[model samples]
Target: MSLLRAGIVGCGAIFPMHAASVAASGAARLVAVCDPDANKLESASQLYGCAGYDRLEEMLERERLDVLHLCTPHYLHPPQAILAAGCGIHVLTEKPMCIASADGEAMIEACRRHGVQLGVIFQNRYNPGARLIREALDDGSLGAIRGARCSVLWSRSDEYYAESGWRGTWSKEGGGVLINQSIHTLDLMRWFMDAEVSRVEAQLANRRHPGIEVEDTAEGLIAFDNGVNALFYVTTAYSHDAPVEIELHGEKGTAKLTADQAVVTYQDGTVISRDRLPQDAMDYGGGAKSYWGVSHFKQIQDFYRSVSRGEAPVIDGREALKTSRMIEAIYRAGRTREPVLL
Candidate 1:
């Protein structure tokens, strides 16, 4: 099949990764980039040799794009995705899906009505550690998961929020560290457990960054429908970023995961360990970070192939909505200091 034409919205820190992923996919070519900031748009356009637009609608109308990648802020995802679906363009958006569960559902409905594919970026799921844990779980080597725990100890300074107009705001960013930075780890936790969340009890705090309206720290207990529970703690209040750590306790044994490595021990004392294969140098763009994993291209390729075959991408809007809803429940539980039923 011919290469699918692609356009990316929001020329933010994450856009470079998306741009590189699209270019490396071999299934799609970058055609345009959209951003409200003229400087950002111009820079990306020049860098990628693609058209630039200050308005999303203008780009959608002017460019014959088969896929639209949403690299914008959390709040813009649902509306931007719905708009692209209305134009009959397949959408692949960055995570959290949207700020609210209702918006996520609407985005899913729009894509379904338009008969276009909708995929969400959860690159961590493609990490070597995540893949290994998932394989063991599926093969029954990990046995039944009895409990799990994950922590995201990353740092974000006051200047980090001061530099961006929307980063610290509740309305724009949806939430703080939990929604933006730790959501990927949360998604992986849920994916590894392979169960629906039944309840969430959470607490939110602004431990360090005072000016920001959103929390810089959060901790929670999530109960799955399958009689399993997981504990999670995420904070940007640390001195520096750390590799996220996740552990799963099962009937057979346990599995521990980090960004690039996994260690699994079976009941019979057999142990297996794996580390992520080195990534292509070309895939690391300006925004690329080691903690972000090097699998954006993998997901982009899968989305392109799914769109080409007229099938749903693995991380479709509905699949992503599960995490989105869980996030909303977490926020609610955090604020009310009560357990929320999902």
Candidate 2:
């Protein structure tokens, strides 16, 4: 009924996006922030004019927050979210939800046990092009699914991994390209297929980034039970942060997605294209693109609505579990050099 008071943990690179989104949303306001890094916490407090704490537990104790937004590192997500849920604060975490499925399940259980909501931020779902494709499928205009191919050619240099100690390590940031850079694509693929992934065969390589523990590149194939199949190639060793592309093929039509643009072709060769959607201003200050315009804000508003209405978020913990499980499958397939059947 009223604006949800919020606190954010981890004032790192993605922290500003979440802070700004919550600040802009009519349904929420960021009242506090937390980070292990004192400098980051101080800077965020100065920027947002909010109280800052070094420990999340302290903030939870000191502030009567209605929501806790987690922009922390991969491995820290589960414990932090579970802690917040235990405090009766709903959680909205950035993806890939957590590094492991067990952590995700535990986080879900904690939230359920405390009677709070758990939401994951896969803001790509709010992208205009993605919404168009999902609408087509829901309306039966895309016909039955046939297959898909997703490509993420974004680049991450050696310095990118070296700059952060927690990143590029399996124990900390999880896997490389698939989990970090292209997880939204993976989620999109799962969303487009609209079915459980039955099998995965994958290969991983650390070609460009020197001394990185995880793969800078990965290639994988996924199969769904009803015979629909998809191929995925992702790498952070490319020339730049290029537009992500996905081609969706259905029985009677096809759709091609590039960033926030889409092109659809009917069985009779009639074509429709959406190439002129309003674009977010480019901010390459941190190398990677900030994100699609207003996606975080849109999702934040929706999550607040879900909390108020006793409904699940558009992308809840269970949906995020699918993405994590797929990433795990890819890694297992690569390590064993055999298809992992799920």
lDDT of 1 by residue, 18-83 (tens): 999888888999999999998898889999999999999999999989999999988899899999
Question: Candidate 1: misplaced stretches above 4 Å?
Answer: 279-281
Model 2's alpha-carbon lDDT is 0.88
Residue 130 Cα positional deviation in candidate 2, in Å, after optimal superposition: 0.5
C-alpha TM-scores of all predictions: 0.98, 0.95
- CA lDDT for candidate 1: 0.91
Minimum summed lDDT over a 10-residue window in model 1 is located at: 278-287
Clashing pairs in 2: none
For model 1, name the residue pairs that clash. Answer: none
Per-residue lDDT of model 2, residues 1-342, tens digit only:
578999999988888778877877778888999988988889889888999999888999999999999999899999999999999999999998899899999999999999999999998888778887888888888789888999999888788899998889999999899899899998998898788999999999998987789999999899988688899999998899898999999987999998778888899888877653446543323233445566777788899899989999989999999989989999999999999999
Residue 175 Cα positional deviation in candidate 1, in Å, after optimal superposition: 0.5
